[model samples]
Target: EDGSAAWLRYAPLPHDSSHSSLPSSIITLNSTRGSPVYTAQQELRRGIQGIFGKTLNNGTSSNQHGAIIVGTAQAYQKSYGEFDDAKELEEDGYFLSSESNQVLIIGQNERGALYGSFDYLSRLAQGKLGAVSYVSNPHASIRWTNEWDNMDGSIERGYAGPSIFFENGFVTDNVTRVAEYARLLASIRINGMIVNNVNANATLLSPRNINGLGRLADAMRPYGVQLGISLNFASPQTFGGLSTFDPLDPAVDAWWANITNQIYARVPDMAGYLVKANSEGQPGPLTYNRTLAEGANMFARAAKPHGGIVMFRAFVYDNHINESNWKADRANAAVEFFQDLDGKFDDNVVVQIKYGPIDFQVREPVSPLFSTLRNTSTAIELQVTQEYLGQQTHLVYLAPLWKEILEFDMKADNRSSKVKDIISGERFRRPLGGSAGVVNVGTNTTWLGSHLSMSNLYAYGLLAWDPALGAEELLQDWIRLTFGHDKKVIETVTEMSMKSWPAYENYTGNLGIQTLTDILYTHFGPNPATMDNNGWGQWTRADKFSIGMDRTVKNGTGNAGQYPSEVAKVYESIETTPDNLLLWFHHVNYTHRLKSGKTVIQHFYDSHYEGAATAQDLVEQWNSLEGRIDVERFEHVLFRQKYQAGHALVWRDSINQFYYNLSEIKDEAGRVGNHPYRIEAEKMTLDGYRSYSVNPFHTASGAKAIV
Candidate 1:
């Protein structure tokens, strides 16, 4: 199954393991046939059989000595007595404990029991199957994964393989993989998944597609995973034969209501609709001169009747930014778009704001819109796909980045307000809030592009459930579950994953300039030369003397002014801006000194060299554990590690040479643009590079030296 089972591969525990007073029977309460309760009961049986080499009997009526009892709070209250702690649990919270050799996995609802079941199984896999007691509740109401999968079986911005939901422009009949995917998601407490690209097609709303969605829903129902869709806002005109898809138009409203009713009719437990409107040429209410709130409220109104939500994306920006105009900035788009319409949206509409103001940059300031939209529901959108952070080819653990975003203080209302509080509906006391991650999984055997990349998927769910969980700790849990509890394997994989994100950022983009990849291509290679004279709103603004966008309020785009007073002042001046994001806010000279007392150009050189060196060390670390895990996964990870090591050198040299060329400066270490195997400028044509005779940095090198 080549990594397809993911972290659910329940290999047997070590025969000589300590604390092996395992449960003798699996017990359940009020477990109706074909319900989530029954599914959980079956899962525990299957998992215990795989781990313990014994099939435990179902002892619901029998008072077995070492029985694992799993059920809802009501079921437990009916079977035993009322549990006082059961009242403490929220809607999806669970209570797990072991007292007097009896284990209890209880949920406020059936879904929580499933989560508790998985947690108990995870502990068993991690060799912690002993006495324990805890009440686990997710901080956020909605923990969702949005897949950017198209109906054509292609995944947009996807480095993994094709889509698992669709094939040849239609839903695949065999959904065995979908069931497995649901199991994987349920294990991580991921309740909902929007399975299509936000840039949607009209065909997704057709009768055939609706039936297919029902099939998918049926497949996922046992695991308690709800299905959602990304709607094409222009569906009224494109699919309903209406003239104008205006939110204010009664005909358009009727069309949406009809569609919503159809969707809910087919799949009773359909999650909701995710809308990306008036952004990047997607048809939106803006076309009809309607406000974004008006655009979103229509969908919300239609879904409200069915108890569904309308997740309106706040990624609205003019891709063709007037960059020649210095004051024009795309970073201000979301704040400007929804700041005034804060109270205008329906209660069921949640504004899904990206973690950063701009697109998913390697390093970026938290989005100001998060604090500004005080009256509307909001959800912090994160990308687990690694689109700008090495696209899963590079081993980048994203939990650290997400933790920073969730932990940032917004200073709303002249007081401290952390982002996690705001998104969890605690800060504003709003009706709804949560986190949404753009998942990178596909039909690839490894789930992601590589086995190591699965950490991002695992960590996203864990962090969404509890943002306070440390990235390193989450990685440890994932490592134990996926590869068993070998000390060497756990330590080695954790170190590599923990170091990966920082190494990737260091080599690709220092001082938060964002990765200098080619904007037109797949965004995979160094192309600093294309930063200027482009309208993607991602400008480096690198001229002969200085680099970076001057976004301070005084002399530039005034984007810093978007933040609250306390945060605004810090970013408004170069002295207070953090060194990591210095270049993101202010344009600086090549000779300008950072807080670390190094020149901007020198920092670039040193960071890239160090990062590349660290990437090679990752290969070494993985090589040291060659025999620690299964040969298949070990070899697969080794192949990726070797590729990443080689590619890191390419990232290092190309970025170093690009900046060196732009500034016409030599590295203080004499490493940049001074490689011993350098190719001359004349021999560094694109054709020569394509032919593998010249390095991408255009330095003199052997044909075989090119990655």
Candidate 2:
């Protein structure tokens, strides 16, 4: 499959399949003209054709066998009687059931039907559709993605080459790639997308570009996807040709109203605006000494007229005061900024909170902002791009990390207070209009840039839809859909992906010092030496005998107080906290003993040596499947795996050598710092990104540079 189709890859099932016992009758309750409900009708027909080699009907039929009935809950209430009502469904949710004879998928709205459609296909594809006998209401209402691609075709933090929606300096006229991307998102029940980078350029909202966006909106319409765009905070002056861009200014409000009108004129159901304000030199209401709410509320006012919402990012920080302490905690900024202004937001504005306090690190505690934003709606942001997780080269499925963040209980004011329930509006019972916005950018034909990596994207969607789903279950489902029905392929790739996070953890940062790498602009490759120097909090605090940042309240950065009483009490003490996150919130010595009964330095030595060794095992494992998969895909992944294996050794050796030098501790195995061999200049083929100049689309050389 080569990962091109993502989870939507629907190969025709063999004739011997027994799902043929499904009923022949298909029916629709109440349908609309080309709405999301209509899209579900269309998709159901397409999926049935691929799966059973039979066409499904849109109108009612006497034969209830294999019949699929879909409608809004209201329509079903009027006709078939909703087993659940609006109050019961909490405004928007879905109820679905299908068996040997009758099948019904009803949503509270058209979009929900579309979601139900994809959920049904996933079940069938995973061979679990026949087992479902329950109605499901989603916990989180906002499932979204942010495409950090500029109209000039450059994708920020994107390893997959340029923006698929952009070529040259303008939006692409060739939109085939854009439509396919929409299908991939819709299959995962992703309902919203911001079409540009957070470092938004004012030029994107110009008439010509909005026209291009209209075309994209139309293509994505059938797939039940809505297009949102990032708004430059100074758009009032820059985009509208105004004298000032102040949120309180009447002119600024009028300018935004005009812009929103112009956008909706072409694509009436445009999702909304995503604003990155007061961060990274971006303009914001803070320039006027107004709260962040003022900046978001201004756009929220404009969007309210059109039934849209404004997603204001909570990822704000300035390194201006960064020189003050040995540890400047960037991880505490979000809650510090937004917690006090919780109830100040307009109804149509959702505070887009990053999962962790710091940027998308390999491992971080859940951001306290999710609990702090009580009145304001919130959407959790995640990055599917493996910026720090070895770029796209290493196979890392991020659902495990995401699951931890989503399921983290903040115990806000109530006991069942988790970040997921908070953002979902379930725990706090507030209105949550925004969804999860993931950063997954790559230009490889597969979209995410790798065959195995598609599982992360797939799992992100499933978990966003239903946060309660097990990470391993989601991984297994993705393995089946993306790679097909091969047992060996399923088992090997699944085992590898599940173990990948821990493996990456072992070699990179034993106790959360973080994968020591340079983080000035791009976050990639091993340079644990540079981890402490960057403006980030990755400092090991290493000296003669000590290592790690001390984030405890009594003797350190006082960041532990950010958590609720429950988590804070546990994390504040070194003995009670998990060993995996030791260095993250605490600064200890090499002599410190972990709960596992191993010394801190020994854990580092063992994990790096073991992790690198496991990477070699990964290559051997994948090599065993040489003839079992598509040769092109198998060989491509094998090449990358082999490279990662070698690179893992580099990570192991570099980290081992760095720590051993610092701690002056020897490996328990007596060979922690041993080098397998150093290659001569002629023997080392690691041209790295220098060799990647092949794809002109990706190369420093330009778009004509494919090797």
Candidate 3:
């Protein structure tokens, strides 16, 4: 239950468990000193010891009792017979096969060898070894996570606490927790990491800081995780002391080339740069009248020769709001800006688009830019840090939400174009840069700081590996990995984790209005009133009659036109749109009857109350496991679940009351809708509700972001 260990909880395998008729012995062909392949050998030994109570003997010799042979393809190709062509395993590829007398694990490189070792262990853990004889891979070329931890010892959007990576304006000398994080990433097949904030400063690339990055790279290399940094587009001006950072300027280009080379020299496997440009006041090419592509191209050129790439962000938005007829839609920025230069970007400059168009709201239409650009290399970005999902306090398993977003068919052609296919580079076969998750793991014992939130991390990896996997299957995998093979633990967590998103959807923001967090500052807790004035796309368009953003070409903002013709018509007409995303796509009157037959306003009222009501059920179910599981994690999850059950009530009443007062609609059941409503104190109208006391933040301060 020490979440510090994350998923690396190498516990004793079940004594009654049985292995398939596959590899029982392991042959680790690792002679190269300090190589990732060697590390693989060590890990395999440890894994086999923990899972099967067998210290797998490492050797170059073949075996008869079904042996697992692991090594770089070159070392084993001659002994185990040629691999026909070993060239395809270029980017950390591995091959595994089961035989009557032995099993062979092949690798094109040491990293591949290590990856193969981990794959072997995972199959053993999942008890899926008897079924397949195939190679394992992460589908995305780049699988990474961004941490918004700063050197000042404070994490930007991190809810778990301060930070495990930094303190006192320097990287942490204690690398134990960070090392465990690398293992977790490795176990889940995450290959890259951005160790700092994307709203990055140039000081991070300075000599004092660069060495810190080098040390981090060293710590991660053993686990096959490469280190990437957030690059400042204004680095030439700030760090190199140049008067201008124009991409056309030779000095700017030269400075970046040198920095990239120096980083490569210090850490031969440095993963390259992540750039945030012209977004929310971050300086970029726009200052010099340059296109966003031009800015990203400069670094892409600099890093190309050194085997690096630049992850250019598509999160640009004008921070200052203009009330004029200009009507700048921040939600429309990524598609508007990037669509023009679709084919202009360098091969290495990936357009990292957020999952939703306007930041990581609870529910949003997939970014239209994802469908618009056919030629550019793109990656979908997701947030694992619960900034908008009640931080780590509320257990909102995001797999279901992600499955909805990833499985969305953009209909680029006659074939339904799901977001997963678009980003995975399979639908169009374009070179996909990779997928990144903004997952912050801070100083809390549960690396997410909360034990239950670990589901998000596990799900991110599985989705990154193969977007085709089901959320139900993933939920099971995470449960087994974290809580072990207990059926009750399985059933209990499955119930809670599976329904949490809807539970969250119910209590926080019904009908896709977003978790009504205080929009101006830290995006936490419920604040429904402040949502109206934010100039955000969540324009309810409600007076006394309706609430929703009208996005149709004929009657709305024409945002729906951004999708391809086949897909555009779905959202353009409210009748065809799914009820889950109805409020997000169209403006409706209070009496607007959803397919469910309830009026739009009434649907909101019903769901919020029902959603909060469900939380009590979650609490009751969790309490049943009080003495069944480890008390540490049990108590931790129990307290949080109970806490969330109460928080759900506050969410239900505030949101329900907000809408009820706005439309003057009475609850059909004669539920409590009175002014100064004690949504918590009076739960009698409904048999189910839990209200927790909270000293909620009162004001909204503009200019500060939620991180």
RMSD of each: 2.5, 4.8, 4.6
lDDT for 376 (candidate 2): 81
How many angstroms is residue 459 displaced in model 2 relative to the true structure, after the best TM-score fit? 1.2
- Give the clash total for candidate 1: 5
Once fitted onto the true fold, the runs of candidate 2 whose alpha carbons sit more than 4 angstroms away are 28-33, 57-66, 74-92, 129-132, 536-538, 676-707
TM-score comparison, 1 vs 2, better candidate: 1
Q: Can you write out model 3's per-residue Cα lDDT over 137-238, one digit (the tens) per residue?
A: 557788899998887778888878887777887777877777778878877778899988887867777676778888888888888888998887888998
RMSD of 1: 2.5
Relative to the true structure, candidate 3 reaches a TM of: 0.92
Compute each candidate's TM-score over C-alphas: 0.96, 0.91, 0.92
- Candidate 3 accuracy as lDDT: 0.78
Q: Which lDDT value does model 3 have at 88?
A: 59
Clashing pairs in 1: 677-700, 678-699, 678-700, 679-699, 679-700
Residue 679 in candidate 2, Cα distance off native in Å: 5.9
Q: Rate the local accuracy (lDDT) of all candidates.
A: 0.86, 0.77, 0.78
lDDT of 2 at 513: 79
Screening candidate 3 with a backbone cut-off below 3 angstroms (N, C-alpha, C), the clashing residue pairs are 409-417, 410-417, 446-449, 540-548, 545-590
As for TM-score, the candidate ahead, 2 or 3, is 3
Specify the poorest-scoring 10-residue window by lDDT in model 3: 698-707
Q: What is the descending lDDT order?
A: 1, 3, 2
Q: What is the lDDT of residue 542 in candidate 2?
A: 75
TM-score result, candidate 2: 0.91
Best TM-score among the predictions, by candidate number: 1
Selected candidate, larger lDDT, 1 vs 2 = 1
